[model samples]
Target chain A: MSARRGKLWSRTVFLLILVTVAGVVLLPILYFLTISFASNYEAYQFPAKILPTFSYPARLRYNADTENYTLLLKKGADFEAVKTTSDASDFSLYCKSQLNVLISPPAVQTLFDRAKASDQAVPIKLRKDFFRNYVVFFILAEGTMRALFNSLKAAGWTILISLVLGGVTGYILARYKFRFSTTFSTSLLVVRMFPAVALSLPLVVYIMRMNLYDTPFALAIVYSVPNIALTAWITSSIFKGISVELEEAAMVFGATRLKTLRTITLPLAFPAIVASSLYAFLAAWNDSITALIMTNDNPTLALLVYRTVGSSTIPNLPAAGAVVLLIPSLVFTFIIKNYINQLWGKVAL
Target chain B: MSYLKLSSLKKTYPNGVTAVKDIDLEIEKGEFVVLLGPSGCGKTTTLRMLAGLEEVTEGSIVLDGKDITHLPPRQRDISMIFQSYAVWPHMTVAENIAYPLKLRKMDKRAIASKVEEVAKICKIVDYLDRYPAQLSGGQRQRVAVARALAVNSKLSLMDEPLSNLDAKLRVSVRTFLKEIHRNTGATTIFVTHDQAEAMALADRIVVMNEGRVEQVGSTREIYNECGSLFTAQFMGTPPANIQKVALASSRGRLVAAAGGGEGAMPLDLGDRSAFPGMEGLIGNEVFLAVRPENIAIGEPDGVNEASIEIVEPQGAYTILVTRVLGGEWKIMLEGDVDFRIGQKVSLKIDPGKVMFYDAQSTKRISLS
Candidate 1:
């Protein structure tokens, strides 16, 4: 074959391989979203609907007497029988239903009611679409988002604290020779392998005694503990590869130890510190079990997602929340993909 | 007054290897001294001790009238260019040259001017902004020189600094270093195993051997009148040849063999009363030490004959190896004197150039 033909053939094969691999990876995600939005009736039908062809209708009870349903506090004993008993004279129940159940937060619920009452009481067709599921998913997602925000807040603090502490500890371990330097270095790894969950009960009791339970501060400390050894070992190895001669050269030029570290040694080590911080961030972000065990009232997204998953009789909404949960981590990993490769190369044995 | 002096220096490692054993040498100001020896000869150790990099196990190192053995390397005002050219790889040539001045807290403007001045002298001005990894080997060596010079220290210690370069570059750098030493007039202590470098660059060469000083003298003095057998063997390219010869008394006078088979030839001993120690024995053994270059092919009045065994034609001179009586010997012939192999050729060894040593002790004896 001619060289041009040969080149064209090879490129076509390469692109075909890439596209096929991408299609395989992306297919399951596309399939899950398609089925999640399909009507529940259609989903359970003889042959499952791969696409939404028709909308399903849902039924809700309204009182003919009061013409309103109370949203909160149905007197505990009448909680299950609240499907009836609405009377037109009970304006408080009507206002409560209008504000709490029929409308959402961060906006005037009355405006939505006005928009609804000015139109039909059916309100946007009452069709059994993904919005009903989305409405529930959004609430859970907000809790998840708060949990996400809390985890991010805790992780941001963890990475910052770990980088400073871990960098100093690593430099001392790698460069200086003290009487017990080896013993000190070995203990870092020992602390990392300590089972965190084994200490969780005691930690929770301690946090409660300190009045730190359900706070992001306590969760951040828990997350930072596991990262100390990992950051130390990784940063120490990088510091070891940097020749002490370079630092001494700076010292000869009148730089003190700290000055030398700031000017010469730290610049060379910046990439490694960044890599370690990313690792610490991911560790804190993905730690669900610790966050769940440590917190109660101010639960993170992982805890909220768990609560949503646990309470659901059916798994569809939770599965939808799970799909949403994976998005931020995916986007974060994609954005820092190059740094991940570099950090991996630096830390890998 | 000497700029640097080492007073009875001693260095012993932790495991008890005495690298430099009681060495004493004084270097005058502006003088270039080279410590030359084979590996493990303690030359490098002594230089390090002087540079304040290595600790002195015993004795004091005084530089410019101040005792500095206990001082650190940076405080001693001594600059050292390592064998590996210890240039910081991350820094540019300008930055490296400016480093010492920066250490002294010199003003930025002055440091820049000094760096430019030294860079121009080393002819690396154009390469100032480039990092060390970008420069050629010769350029890096020049940068190392510039960095050392920028400090303007009292003493400069160079440890085989040009050993890494190619031969042509080595010669150029060697010449440049000599010129720099002369212009700056800094007391320099260079260490090298290359004899040619020591011979070319030193004002006084201190020959070391196995942790002790073998000889210390000018280049000509060491070559002409070597104090030990090691010095004589080490200084020359082909080295001096030593052979055992039977000295016999003729007419109650002692003389060594003059190269005829089995007592047929004899050398005249001028005085009988002299060398009275030979009275008890008419025959004894002695060592004849002569350099290869001192021996010639043809007879020159007081000469001997030996059968040529092999002839080697080097570019400047031809060396003939010949067997005389019981043993083989070598002689250097002037120019391209192509004497055929296995030819019985007349050879001349100038008696004045030959040295005498005791056969058993290998110690120099009374020449008369």
Candidate 2:
């Protein structure tokens, strides 16, 4: 009985430790989601309850003659309120702007009759204004989507440019020896280690002078430089691991030099090519500083996230936009996660 | 006419290592020539140079009548099997065999028929669709041979192809190779470091050492009439034991040493007129080369006293290590000699079979 009890206690301790770790990691994300759904009145409440346990409807009292407590609203109307309700100011005014709200005939009649028949004016409730923040957020998120599409386009072209150029360079660097082969390989790594941000200032001025700013083509060209170095170094190491004797055997069997490379060498190095492309894609996708400095009118998704931090007003629209930005890269990684082992030639984790 | 001839072929690397130095070899229409030597003896390098796999530093490689020294391996019209087999790991047995045919753009029917024919010839018909990794070592070696045969070249260059096999497998494969050569009449240049393999399979064995040919002849010729002292010592299993013995010369006629008594057998060292410098060489030492099989145990009449140091009784013959001529010499005697260690035994050397060499130069002297 004591051993069984001790086992249960250990399992409980393990679960507690796991939960503590998860809570620490997920607390900020949980806070942001709660803030997105909380009402302004509830947000300003003392000892604020961020999570709603029960449905709390807005309540308003009528004049002394009528005992009905109801929500006062008008169709195609505007109203102001002056009252003391919760700890915060109760005189919150609501104005219906240029937003369409669908209402039932009976509920519209009830709101209209209450505002017209009462001597003391009833407060008007605006349903559209409560959701107006999301409307602005939707437009900004659409812009973010366009920016993200542009970034993917740039990264895609960068991968194409880097792979073709880097793959051939990588194969030669790995297989052949010349006078400066080691020096050439190390120089590529030096290019890769150079800070992209350090060059962005001069790059931006050059792009502006060349009239190539605010274009996906300009971003792709800029992104290809760093990705080429990275792809070449990475793919070259992987290509070096493959045996050269296989290619020689193919040639001995009457295959031409090109045919031998096509049939034997390329297939063996394909995984390295794909892995290099993935590294190229991620490098272009996550890069923000260069894109921020290079273009003003057309921004990448990463640049858009950086633009969301205003001085006095934290733009919730871009905060929500940042959340959408994480989805595509996450989906891409998850889809190709199985091939990662083959790509790297080993199990990564 | 020879099917393939390499006249004065040479290979020197850029690092100043001369791998092959003026090698000349000719393979007749169906003759099997083996380049036999120890490692780094330029035998493999010579074979590679013939196959057009190694660049020749000098000389011409002629196949049939055309010079092919500068031709690439694919255009050389020859097949080579490496020591590692070099079989395509990703391809099946049939695909590997049909590779050379496919490169020529042969029709599907022809490819299938040729692959089937070669597979049957190699006795791997059932394993036509299996990859090399799935086959046994011996089977893979046979597939490598079949792949080479599928090319249908005039010559086959094999570089220690059976070295990877076990002893029994190596023997069986060596027999298989010899039988195939007999049937196909393809001029084969085989390279091996194993002396026994070369002796069993080669029509003419070219013994090489340090990028130079030591001797090149039939196994019987190399064994019976080894010209150099190196060849005599390198050929046999228990190599020829050399010793220094002095003989007496009087009036230009040579006889046994003075220590031998009146009943001692006289050694006829023919024609002292040819050996003009023997007048002052009465006490001079002369080298005697005797094969271990020529020595025998006998009575004291024709025997010399020697103490047996060790006796190893093999199944059919026993090898006795005895102190003879002031040093230990391994003596091969037929049957179990039941001789114990430290036993004083009488040893007889057949004077007619004994070889004499100039003591200073280590060259064979006239003994007829």
Candidate 3:
């Protein structure tokens, strides 16, 4: 009975810890998603909403003594007079900028005349266009689609370059026992230790001399510098776990060394290769400073999103951009998760 | 010309350690030859050199009239089963067998048929579609065998293929491999450290020690007529009982005396005429080796009297342990012969079966 109770106590503690960790990770993303869907007015709401709001109950009233129109917004059960405007255009502008509720000046003037003639408060019913922030971000932002394409191209090239060069280096390091192999392997880590920013300045000059400046390929070249070393480090250990006799068996069975690598070694090391590609992709996809120095007219989406955050005080536009930036990374990670699981020995290939 | 010939095969690593030193062997076609040795005896190195997996440092290998000393493994028509049973984990059993055929540019239909044929022979046909990781170690070993057999190469090499299996599985696989060899009739060179596996499988066994071949012969010759002290000591379970003794003639018979003093009692070894040309060296010290089964236990009379120290019943045969010539010696008696500990017994050394070697050189001495 004591053992059972102890087991139950441990399970309860484990569950509490699991929930805390999940909330810590997921709650911020949920709040960010709500902000991405929020309007300019909703962005400034106090105590900020964790869930998106679509519509608000409001009332427009004409004050007789002040000779102005008052906008009353619903706050819980009661109405709060948030703003007052004297003229029709002023009221229209206020609603458009602060409330993010579109109202033409002529329509506002008619409503104001009706409110003044009748001594009663007029009810104003408004529904929010929830996807308006996302639509406006894409429409107003310059070269957003082009930046998205450039980010993809850069990440694609990074994966290609790193996997090809690093995979061959990994195979050689795992198989051969030449002189200074340990020294060579340790030096690859030293190369990774140097920050990519330190290399970007000198690399830009060479990139320009080759007439490849401001291109996604130039950015990929910078991204692949640190990524190749990282990829080689990861893949070499995994390749070591693979048996060398498997390759020798292939060779002894009348397959050439190249053919053996293609049919045997590469397939056996595929999960690690896929995992390395994910690292290479994220490095190129999420980098801003390296792309900042390496590109000019052709900035990647991450750099574009970073620039958007600086230009806007209201975060809705930039939040929308960040969500858009997150989709591809999420998709790639989801696809590569199975391969990573295989690397951890969860599934046999 | 021999089907496969290795002339002066020597392997010296880059660090200047020699694994195989000047090995010369010739194997005829359709013969199953086993290289038997302890670990680091260079048997695997010799097999690897023949398979073109290792570089031939100061040697030449000629296989079926082709000088394939430096050719890569693919260019040489040979198939090898690794000790780890390296059936490709990424491939299904059928794909593993078909891959070599595909590399040879055989048609897809022919490759499929050949895979089916070998899979049936190896009894892995039911698991043709299953990956190697899904199969047990023994089944994966059969997949490796099927893959090697699928190519129908000029030669087949197995490097301790059955070493990874359980003991019972090892014996069954040994018989299965021998049966496969008989059916296929491919010239095979198998490397193993197990003497029983070698004896059970090989048409001729090449016993190796250190980096050189100690002796090569049929099982009976290697067992009863070992050419060197190393072969005699290395070839048997419980091994041969060896002692350093001086031969002396006593009572019109030849005897081997063990210690130097008054306490020394000579073990009787039959007539002097049996050991021709050994009469001149009667007083010279020589090494005497006797198999456990060769020495007979009888009623104590006075010659080579010793007390039985232990008795071990092994289901079919009983091993009786006693002291002979001041060294612990084992005697194999058939079928549970009851013997008590500390009981006095007489040990009769078989004169014809007793082997002698020069103490300095450790080489066998001819008696007749």
DockQ of each: 0.13, 0.19, 0.58
lDDT of 3 by residue, B78-197 (tens): 999999998887777888889889989999889889998998999999999887878888999999899999889999999999999999999999999999999999999999999999
Runs in model 1 deviating more than 4 A are: A1-266, A269-281, A289-349, B242-289, B299-314, B317-347, B355-368
Pairs that clash in candidate 1: A65-A88, A66-A86, A66-A87, A66-A88, A147-A300, A147-A301, A253-B103
Winner of 1 and 3 under DockQ: 3
- The models' CA-based lDDT, in order, is 0.71, 0.72, 0.89
Which sections of candidate 3 miss by over 4 Å? A62-69, A83-96, A100-125, A343-349, B259-264
Q: What is residue A348's positional error in candidate 1, in angstroms?
A: 20
lDDT, residue B145, model 3 = 92
Model 3: CAPRI class: medium
For model 1, what is the error of residue A188's alpha carbon versus the real structure, in angstroms, after optimal superposition? 8.5
Off by over 4 Å in 2: A1-138, A141-149, A160-188, A199-239, A295-299, A305-349, B242-304, B310-328, B332-339, B347-368
For candidate 1, lDDT tens digit of each residue in A252-321? Answer: 4445667778867876676678678878877776667787889876776666667787886555566566
Residues A60-109, candidate 2: write the lDDT tens digits.
44544454333432212432232322211112222211222333445644
lDDT of 3 by residue, A221-243 (tens): 99898888888888898899988
| Top candidate by lDDT | 3
Report fnat in order of the candidates: 0.14, 0.29, 0.75
